[model samples]
Target: MQFDNIRGFLFDLDGVITDTAALHAKAWAGICQRLGIPWTDALAEGTKGVSRMDSLEVILKSVNRQDEFTMAQKAQMATEKNDRYQELITHLTASDILPGMKDFITDLKQHNYQLALASASRNAPTVLKYLGLSDVFPKIVDPSNLTKGKPDPEIYQHAAALLNLEPGQCIGVEDAPAGVASIKAAGAIAVGIGDAHDLAQADVVFPGTASLTLTALRGKLEDGVLNA
Candidate 1:
C-alpha cells in the first residue's frame, strides 16, 4: 500500500478542484428539458467524469432517444450546453476554489511532485484561469484528442505520459467513480474526494478537499488502509 514511488499528481478539474460539476449538471438539465427528456439524479451522475458527447449519449439513451439525433444536431446541442456552462462559470473566482486545495497544491509543488490535469472537460484551462490557478498545472490532457473518456484509462494514461512518468509513479485525484476507475485501471493510486461509499474503488477516500493532505494520505497508505 505504500506509494513510495509516487512522484506525480494527476487531477480532475470539476468536482475535485471546484464546484463546477453543479454548473455542468444545470446545463445538462437545460439540455434535457429542451429535448423533452427527464433529468434524473442518475442521469446527472452518469455524466460525471465523462466527455460532452458521451454525456449526451447517456442522456439520449435514458429514454431510448439516442438514435433520434444526427451527429450535426448532437454537435449543436453540445455547443449549446458549452455556451450555457460558460455563462455559469463566469461567476467563478479564486473563492470558488475548494478549501485546502491551494495549500495542498503548494505542498505538492514544494515537494517537487509533478502535476498535470486529466479532466474530461475541454474548458479546463479556462476554468483554471478563472480560479486564478492558470499556472498550477503545466500539462493538461486535451479531452478533444482522447479517443476514450474516464473509465477507459486513456485519459489518465495520457496524463501520466505528459508528466513523463509511469502511471504507477503517480497519484490520481478525482471526485467521481468513473475517474477513480480510470486511475486504477491505469495502474495509479486513486484518491477520492467524495463519499467513500460512492468511490469505494479508490485507494483512499477523503470526504472533501479539506481532508486531503499528504501526511494523512501517507499515513493511510502506510497503515494499509488502502480501501478506506
Candidate 2:
C-alpha cells in the first residue's frame, strides 16, 4: 500500500483537514433553530461531506418539512446557512488546520506529489484562505457546480481530471463514509481519516490526520499495491 508511486493526493476539507466541522455544525444548528427543528449531533453527522442543498434536505427531512419547501425556498435557506457559516469561520486562524496536516502536506509537496481538493463545500476557497492554506491545492473541484455530490464519484473524478492524472493515480483522503465511497467509485485509493468502522469502505483507515505520517501512509499504500 505504499503511496510511493501515487501521482497526486486529493483531500477533503472540514473534518478531514480542519476543525471547521464544528463551525459548520453550529451554522446548521442556527438554521434548525430558525426553522423550529430539533438539532442533534447524530443529525449533524449526516450532513458531513454533503452539499449545502443536500445538507438542507437532510435537515428538512428531520423536521418533517422536506416536502413543504419548494426548490426556491430551500435554496434561500441553504444560502442563509452559508452566510452564517461564513461569519463563524471569519475568526479562524492557522490553529484551525488539523494537527499533522501541515507537515504531511509539506512532505508530500517535497516529494513532488500533486495536490488537489475534492470537497462538497462551495466555501472551499474562503475556508482555505482563513486557515492560511489557500496555496496548497491548485486544483479544487467545486461540487456546487455539479449536479451530484459525494458517493457519486463525480467530485473526486473531476479533481483527478483537473490534476491531469487518472483516478487510480490519485489517493483521496476523507473523514466521511460518503466521501470514501466517492473516491473508491472514482477508482482512487480511499484513505479514511476517521474510525475504521465508520469508513470501512476505504482501502485503509487512519484514526485521524494527527496519527498519519508520510512514511506510514506510504507503507500502507505500498502494502495495498502488493496485495492488489
Candidate 3:
C-alpha cells in the first residue's frame, strides 16, 4: 500500500474536502418534497457528490417519479435547489473549512506534491475560491464536463491527465463509494477518508482527517501503504 510512486494527489471536493454534502442533500430533499415526490434515504445518498442534473436523474428514477416530472419541471426544480445551494454555500466561512485542510494543502505544496481538485460537484470552483483553496489546485475537473458521473472513470482519468500525471503516479482521495470506484476505474490507488461501506474500492481506509496530517500521510506513503 506504499505510494512511493505517487507524484500528485487527486481529491474529491464534497465531504472529503468540504462540508457541502449536507447542504446539498437538504436542498435536494426539500425540492423533492416540495414537488410531491418521496425523497427516500437511498435516493439522497446515491446522488451524493453527483452533479445537479445527474442527481435529479437518480432521485427521479429512485422514487419512480421519472414519469411524474416533465423535462421543464426537472429543470426548474434543479434550478431552485441550486439557487438555495448557492445561497447556503455563500455563507461558508473559514470556520467551515475542514480541520486541517489549509495546513495540509500548504504542507503538500511546500513538499512539491502536485495537487488537483477532481470533484463531481459543479459548484466546486466557486466554493473552493470562496474557501481560499482555489489557488492550491491548479487543475480541476468538475462535474459538468464528465460524460459519466462517479462510478465512472472519466472524471478521475480526466483529472489525472489534467494534472499531467499517470493514474498510477497519483493517489485519489475520496469519501464516497462512487468516487472510490471512479478512482479505481481510472487505474489509480484509492484512499478512503471515511465510511468504508461506501468506499470498498479504496486501497486505504482512514477514519478521519484529524490524524491525517501531512507527516502522517507521508509516513504511510513511504511505508508503502497506498499501492503497496
- Judging by TM-score against the true structure, name the best candidate: 1
lDDT against the true structure, each candidate: 0.93, 0.87, 0.81
Name the candidate, 2 or 3, with the larger TM-score value: 2
TM-score of 2: 0.95
Model 2: per-residue lDDT, tens digit, 85-127?
A: 9999899888988999999999999989999999898898998
Which portions of model 1 miss their true places by more than 4 Å?
Answer: none
User: What total of clashing residue pairs does each candidate reach?
Assistant: 0, 8, 9
Best by lDDT: 1
State TM-scores per candidate.
0.97, 0.95, 0.91
Tens-digit lDDT string for candidate 1 (1-228): 656888999999988889897899999999999989989999989998899999999999999999998999999999999999999998899999999999899999999999999999999999999999989997999998899888999999999999999999999999999999999999999999989999999999999999999889889988988775
**What's the C-alpha lDDT at position 1 in model 3?**
55
Q: If the candidates were sorted by their TM-score against the true structure, best first, what order would they fall in?
A: 1, 2, 3
Residue ranges of candidate 3 with Cα displaced over 4 Å: 221-228
Off by over 4 Å in 2: 224-228
The deviation in Å at residue 182 for candidate 1 is 0.3
Q: Residue-wise lDDT of candidate 3 within 30-61, one digit each (tens)? A: 88788677877787678876778889988888
